[model samples]
Target: MSLRVLALLVLLSIQNLFAQQLSPEASIRVLTIGPGYNLNDAFGHSAFHIQDHSQNIDMVFNYGVYDFDTPNFYTKFAQGKLHYLIGVNYFDDFMLMYKRQNRTVQSQELDLDTGQKQALFDYLLENYKPENRRYLYDFFYNNCATKIRDVLQTAVGEPIVFHEPEAFQPQTFRTLIQDNLKTNSWGSMGIDLALGSVIDQTATAEEHMFLPEYIHTFFSSATLGNSNKKLVKQDKTLYTKQAINSNKSSFFTSPIFVLGVIGLFIVIITYFDFIKGKRSRWLDFTISVLTGVIGLLLLLLWFATDHTATAQNYNLLWAFPLNIILGIQLLKKQPKPWVIKFLKFLFIMLALMAFHWSVGIQVFAPVLIPLLLALVIRYMYLVYYLKNEKL
Candidate 1:
């Protein structure tokens, strides 16, 4: 027999033996980190903490780690093809990092027998291996927080009953996300614009684990299938977040204020052009171009990407992609008669957008209210001007 083959067999046996000998004193914990001020950190994070007193081993298994150096990183991220990997860190280092960020760190020890603990530990070690580490990340489903719930189910080899946390109210995926963001902030507006109506659907109780805070709450009340034993044995606050001075952005710099200013300018210009009975071709051209470009990007996000959350976007109603061609036609001394119909179509699209919002099909950014009203006025003015010019 080859020495290499014999050595490999012996190594595999040793690994199996070590896995089986997981100390009864070992404990598996779920760590929940509080949200930070940044948009990326708004949702918070979750990880597995494995500590074995007998073996003097303490490590953290994190599913949120991603490499910025991956090929076509930005492009893949936009396409929703980015991969996140499991990363192992020293327990102290993990706690210290979150502590420095002034984020609250909470830990929940699981109530599991030695067999279940060993199974979970072995599973994490297997997942930590290079070839098995990376997985496709999804914001609403297979993310860092969801991984905690998933790994527990897998290791325990049973369905987990995630009971509703106290005072738990069912909320749409979008609502759940917006709960973590300020209403008039640019971050919230961007999310409303980029994501689509799919997020408007209410999330199931078990599905709410996609957020770290929910993971902590749900796991606290979770139990193994057909068993009344609680999933979490105890909870501890490792580091309480310290209150800091408010660094909120100025109100003038907020999305509502900025967009409101721009919208008011458009309305004032359109009113003047209506009184003068003259079309402000430059202003119309600029608005059409900007809205058209944004619409095209939204369309691409819906159609050309793997993002499930970007489907059926309603923002395109106001920012019509066909406006780009209409803008170019307006630059002509004599645009075709069809331009009038196109203007009317844009007005109808605005009305439809309102209808969707009212009927709860989709919820648009509140910051866009002023801009939408301005678009309606401009479209109506353009239609009247084109009709009078033809007379």
Candidate 2:
């Protein structure tokens, strides 16, 4: 066959195989984010106010800082409005809206990625003086923020009020982008692109205040989020040829996740040991067990997360320490024989899964898999031997 004929056949085959994946529309969804009544919303207070008029929104997601002394809102806005997001909903909505109409986030192409953000910030600190930071601020505001409002207005056919950066001063979009903006580094230009993404209507930004009451609100209101309620479709099939061969590691390459499983087993053991009169101080033992559970949750999050923005999720890296603590507690328990035997079986299974996953990582897999197996086996045997000897 001629090359053109061959190309046509390949295209048809691919189309027939997948039939164009489409997110089934549900009520023309528009996501809105708003501020918590409190200060903790990670974005800014001004954003929350804009989000309050949620008449057009299909889903409203609120974000707030964790209970740490530094709140998430106080974190610098990504040149104002953009955030590091990698979730299915964001992806689905973006793809859908673009297909529904020729909606674009940029007037000109803006490759908004992590490298772009770093390059832009670096340029500012290098070339611009502290007192002359107006150049930096002006470029971000007019080129990034105003262009954003203009783009959304074109799509929604309504004048949308975007959450301008705290540093924002109202100026003509043309003046900002064409005149002052050109003088700054090309990196600064990208910052405008990224910030433009964050506050755009399809992917709005808000301040989420995560209060203890927010959890309580969900529990108290039958209409709200239920932890027990399941999203069954979220479960993905494992061990496919692609899944097996892809460089991305699933449950196996996730060290924190694997440790979470180990911690859970330890907690179960500790509870049983207390029941068997082998240990006391239930609360302390319970804490030891819970550490594993929490670490495991962190592990799953790490795996599910967008690794391209590792810095955003860096807090979860500390989950490793908790996993270690859980291991120590398990070893201290001096397990009963049945418990040791069961753990030995689990260790073998976990090791096999790790090995399967490591196939993708090649040599790195070999080192990580064996080390994990040794840790599980070593701790289990130590507990078993101590228990039998009553030491």
Model 2 regions lying over 4 Å from their true place: 1-71, 74-294, 297-334, 358-370, 376-380, 383-391
Clashes of each: 0, 8
lDDT of 1 by residue, 225-269 (tens): 788889899999999999989687999999999999999999999
Clash-forming residue pairs, model 2: 35-48, 41-208, 42-72, 42-73, 63-208, 64-208, 81-198, 82-198
Q: Model 1 compared with the native: what TM-score?
A: 0.94
lDDT of 2 by residue, 1-391 (tens): 5746754654443334232222222112122222221222211111000111132222211122121232352342322222321111122343343334322211111112233223322332222232422221122232222222232234332233223344434332222222222222232223222122122112112111111211111212212122332111121211111112324335453544554566565556655754574543343335335435644554543454332211122222222325444444555545345555444554554555455344521111122333344346444544555465564
Evaluate all candidate structures by whole-model CA lDDT and list the values in order: 0.89, 0.31
Off by over 4 Å in 1: 1-20
